[model samples]
Target chain A: MKKDIAKLLQRKKKQIIDLWMKNQLADASLREDLMSNEELLEQSDELVNALLSKLTDDNLSNAESTDFDDVYEILSGISISRARQGFSPRETGVYIFSLKDALQEIVQQELRNDPVTLYEVSIKISKLIDSFGVVTFETFIKGREEVILRQTDEIAEISTPVIRVWDGIVALPIIGTLDSARTQVVMESLLQEIVDTGSGIAILDISGVPAVDSLVAQHLIKTVSATRLMGAECIISGIRPEIAQTVVHLGIDLSNIVTKSTLASALKHAFTLLQLEVRRKQKETSTLKSNI
Target chain B: MGHFLLVTIQVDLYDRLALNLEADLVQMVSKTGARGVLIDISAVSIVDSFMGRIIGNIANMTKIMDAETVVVGMQPAVAITLIELGLPLTGVHTALNVEKGMELLRKKILVDGEADNSDDEDQPGDGAE
Candidate 1:
C-alpha cells in the first residue's frame, strides 16, 4: 500500500505541484512579494519530490523518523528561508499544509477501490504531513530568532568605541546608562587600549550619560581604579551639576577620583599630570588680532 | 634588593595570611633599616575589603617607621574590586612596575634628603645671618 501511494505520488508529481500552488494562491495570506509565484512553484516542486522519495507505509505514521530526514530537511529549508524573506507565519503555514491537501486528494482518488486500506493509509499520511507542517513552523521561528540574535550581537559591537584624544590619553565617552554588562565591556576595552598604547591617562566623559545613580557611580569608580591599576590615571569628566548633586545626596565618596565639570578641564588636568604644555602662539594676522 | 626591600606577593592570600604579612612587612622594614619598600602584587588576583585595609595599614605602618612604600604591579581586576569594596587606596603610592616604583621611591627619598640638608644648612646660616 505504501509503495502504491509512493508510485501514485511519483507519477502525478506535476499535477501535485500545480494543485499545491493553486491551493497556496487561493489562500489570502500568500506573500507574493517575499516569494514570487515562479520561485514558490520551484520550491513546491523540490519539497514534493523529497516527500514522495521518502514516503513508505511504515514511515507514514511519523515524520520525525530517520527515514523522513530528507523530506524534513527540505521542509525546514523552505520554512526558514521564507521567514528570513519576511513571509508571514500564516503564509508559511499554508505553504506546507497546502501541499498536504494536494497530496491527500490524489491519495484518496488512487485508493478508491479498497476502503479499509485507504482509511488506514490516508490517516497515516495525514499524520505524517501534520508533523512536517509543525516542523516547518518550528524552524521558521528559529530562523527569526537567529536574525534577532545577530542584530543584538551587532548592537553590542557598535556601542563601545575607545578613541585616542591625544598621545598618552584615551577618551571613552559613554553615551547611555551605565550598566554592569556595558561596564565590563568598557573596562576591558579601556584596559586593553591602555596596555596596548601605554597611555598614562584615560578620560571617561559622562556628558552623554543621561543619569548617574549609586550603581553607576560604583561602576565608574571601579573603572577608574582599574585604569589606575594599569598604571594610568582616570578622570571622570563631564559631570553635570545634577549628577554632582546626586553623588553628594547619595553620599558616595568620589573624593579620591579626579572629576572635572567638563572634558576640556579634564584634558587640561591630564596635561598637568603628563607635564604637557599647550601654549597658544601670538596671532600673526592683523585682522585676527583686531578681532581678539 | 638594596637598602630598599622588594616584597613580591605571588600567592593568593587568604584572610589571616594577609593580616600576618602586613605585620611582618612593617617589622622587616624596621629590622632591615630599609629606606624604601616596594610590594609587587601583580600576581595577586582577588582582593577584598579586609585585604584592602591590610594594604592601607601596611602603608601607614611603614610610613611611621620612616620608610617609603610603593605598591607596584597591581592587576586591573584587583583594583576594580578594591574600589568597589569602598577602599579607594588613599595615601597609597602605586606604580606600574618594580622599576617605576623604585624610581619613585628613590625620587621621594632624594627629595626628602634635599629638604633635610636645606633645613640643616639654612637653620645655622639664617641664625648667624
Candidate 2:
C-alpha cells in the first residue's frame, strides 16, 4: 500500500510537467520546480493564465518597438544585396518585408532554430515575396492608368485598333489592349454612361488598340452581351486588316458584336438606323408652334 | 449637431465633376455643423473601388472629425461590382436616393437639436403638450 501511494504521486508530478511543457512555459527546470511544490501545483492554472496574459500584453506593446528608421535600414540592406544579385528595389522590398515578418514570428515563438529550417524558410519567403512584388508593381502601373481613365471624362476623341458598329445604329469605340481587367472597367463605364447620356446610337471605336488576342475578343463579346442587357447598343469600330485576318485564322466569331471600318462611318450609319431625322423635324415643329 | 451630413451631387456623372467632388461636399457639410454625412451618388454612372474606399475612409475620418458618413445611390450592378472588387465601404451610410438620404439626415439633425434645446430650456414646470 505504501509503494502504490508513492508511485501515484510520481505519476501526478510527471503529468504536471508534461502539461507545463505543452503550454510553452518555462522549460524543464521550471516544470520540475512546479511539480515538486504542492502549493505551486495548487495555483498552476492561475499562474499559467497570468503568464499568458502578460506575454500577450507585452507583444501588443512591443509591436511598435521597431521604428520606421529600423525598417528602412533593413529595407536598404536588402535592396543593396538584391542589386548585387541583379534584382530591382521594388522586388527586393517585397522579398525583405515577407522574410522579416516570418522571421519575427518564428523568433516570437521562442523555438530552437534549426539552420536547415531557417534556410528553407528564407528561400521560400524570398521567392514568394519576389513574385508578389512583381505583381504589386504591375498592379501599381495599372492603377495609374485607372486613375487617368477615371479622371478623363472630358476626352473628345480616342482611337483604337478595331471598332465595331452595332445594328448599324451605334458606334463602339475601344482604345488600348483589352485585358480582362480593363475590359470589365471599360464595359461597365461605357454601358452606364450610354444609358445616362440617352444616346440613341453608340460608336465603339477601337483604332488605338495595338493588338487583339483571343481573351480580348471574348471580353468584347461579353461587353456586347452586357450592353444588350442594359437596353443599349454596341458597335465595334476600327478593325485593322491584319486583326481581321487573325480573327478568321483563330476562328473567333465576332458574330454577336457589330463591326465597322471607321468611327465616322459608324456614326453616320447609326444616325440613319435610329431615324433621327424624324426627331429633328419634330423638334423644329414644336419650336415653331411655341413661337407662334 | 446631428450625426449625418446630407450633400447632393447634382452632376449627371461624378467623374465629370471635380476629382475632389466628394471631399468638397463633405467639407460643405462640415461647415454646416453636421456631425454625419450622406452622399447622393444616384447620378453617378461608374463607381470604382478607389472611389468607394475614399467614401469609406471619409466616413472613418469623419468620426475623428466628430461626424459620421453614409453613401447612397448604390445601383444593383454597382453594388455587385463593388463586392466583386473586394472593396469594403462599411462605415458609410447608403440610401436608395437623394431624397431618402436627406430625410434620414433631417431626422437625425432634428432629434439631436431638440434634445440639446430641451436640455437648455429652464421651464421645467411648463404644461405638457
Candidate 3:
C-alpha cells in the first residue's frame, strides 16, 4: 500500500501539536504580552484537531476541498480575533508557517526510509499551509476595516453637539470636515434643539473645521435657510480670514445670512436679537471695604 | 377668528384640505375684515411643493385683503423639505410659535396701521387695539 500522508499525520496528532507549539513559542516575534501562553495553546489545539479531523488521502493535497471548510472557518476566526487583539501580520504569518514546519518535520521523520514519499508529502503540506496564510492575512485586514468603520460612525455622532448657550439661544460647534451625511446630522440636531429650547437665535461655530469649500458653504446655506424656516435666526460664526477670502472668491452669496468673525461676536449678536444685555456691577470693591 | 384669524393645522395636509383651507381662509378674511392671519403649523411634519405653494397663495390672498399672514412652529424637517422644493416662502412672515406668531402679526398690523395713518390725515386712532 502507498504511504498515506494524511493518515500518518492523523496518527501523530499529539506530536504535531507539541512541535507546532514549541515552534511558535520559540519564534522571536511571538507576542506573549497580547495573548496568554495558555490561550495560545488552546487555540492551537483546536486548529490542529480541526485540520487533522478533515485530512484524508484524496483531499490532503487539495486545500480548496469542501472537507477543509471547518479548517478554514477555524483559521479565519483565529486570524480575525488575533487581528482585533493587536497581532501584527508578521506574527500571524509566522503562526501558520510554524505549524507547517512542525507537520513537515514529523512527516520527514515518519518516511525517513523513503525519500520520494517524503518529498511529495512535504510539497503538499507547503501548498496547503500557504493557502491558509493568505486567508489569515485577508481576514486580518477585514477585521481592522470593521474597527475603523465603527470609529468613524462614533466620531460623526459625538462631533456635532448643540449647546443651549442662553435663554432663547443655542450654539452648535461643528468639528471636522463637513460631508453631506454629517450635514444632515448637524441640521437635524440644530433644528431640534431650536424647537426644544424655543431659541430664536442659533450660532454655528465652525472654528474646529479645517477648511471651507463651496460644497461646505452650500451646506451652511441650506442649514441657515432651514433654521429660518423654523422661525429662528441662524448665525454662521468663526469665519477665519482664509475662509472669508475663499467665500468671496467663490462668490457664494452669504449676504442674506448673518456671518460673524468670532463666536464672541456671534453670541453678542444673539444677545442683541433676544434684546438681552450683560452689565457688571460698579464699585463692588468699595462696598466690600466698607462692610469690612 | 377675531381681529386676527388663527388657523391651527392639527392634521396632515392633503390636497383637498389645503385647497379648502385656502378658500375658507380667504373668505373668512374678507367676511370678518380680519387684519391678521396667524397659521400655527407646529403639528405638521411633512410638506411638499403643493403645500408650499398653497402657503404662498394664502399669504398672497391675505396680503391683497390688507391682512398680514404669519406662519409659525414649522418643524426642521418640513422646513428643509420646503427649501429643497425651491419654495422659501418669501414675503411670508415666520415666528417660533403661536404666541410669537401673534406678536409678529400684531407688530405687522401696527406698522401697516401707522403707515396708513401717515398716508391719510393724521388721526388719533390706535387701530390695533
True contacts kept of each: 0.44, 0.00, 0.78
DockQ, candidate 1, comes to 0.35
Query: Clashing pairs in model 1?
Result: none
Position B95, candidate 2: lDDT: 47
**CA shift at B118, candidate 1, in angstroms?**
9.3
Ranking by DockQ: 3, 1, 2
Worst 10 residues of 3 chain A by lDDT: A278-287
Per-residue lDDT of candidate 1, residues A1-292 (tens digit): 4466767777888889889989999988887777788988888888888877776666667667898788888888888888898888887887888877887888778888888878887788788878987898899999999999888667656777888999989998888888897888788888777766667789999998899999999889889877876567899999999999999999999999999999999999999988898865654466577988
Tens digit of per-residue lDDT, candidate 3, span A1-292: 3447778899999999999999999999999899999999999999999999999878877989999999999999999998899889899999999999999999889999989888888899899999999998999899888889889889989998899999888999999999888998899999999988888899999998888899999899989988988888999999999999998998888999899999999999888887888755566777777899
Q: Evaluate model 3: give its TM-score.
A: 0.81
List the candidate 1 regions with Cα displacement exceeding 4 Å.
A1-14, A25-42, A56-68, A83-91, A107-135, A210-218, A240-256, A272-292, B1-32, B39-69, B74-93, B98-100, B103-129
Clashing pairs in 3: none
Model 1: CAPRI class: acceptable
Candidate 2: interface RMSD in Å? 8.7
Chain B TM, per prediction? 0.85, 0.64, 0.87
- Give lDDT per model, in order: 0.81, 0.52, 0.88
Candidate 1 lDDT over B1-129, as tens digits, reads: 137889888988988889889989988987888878899988988777777778888888999888888888877666666665677688888877787787778767766766777654333221100
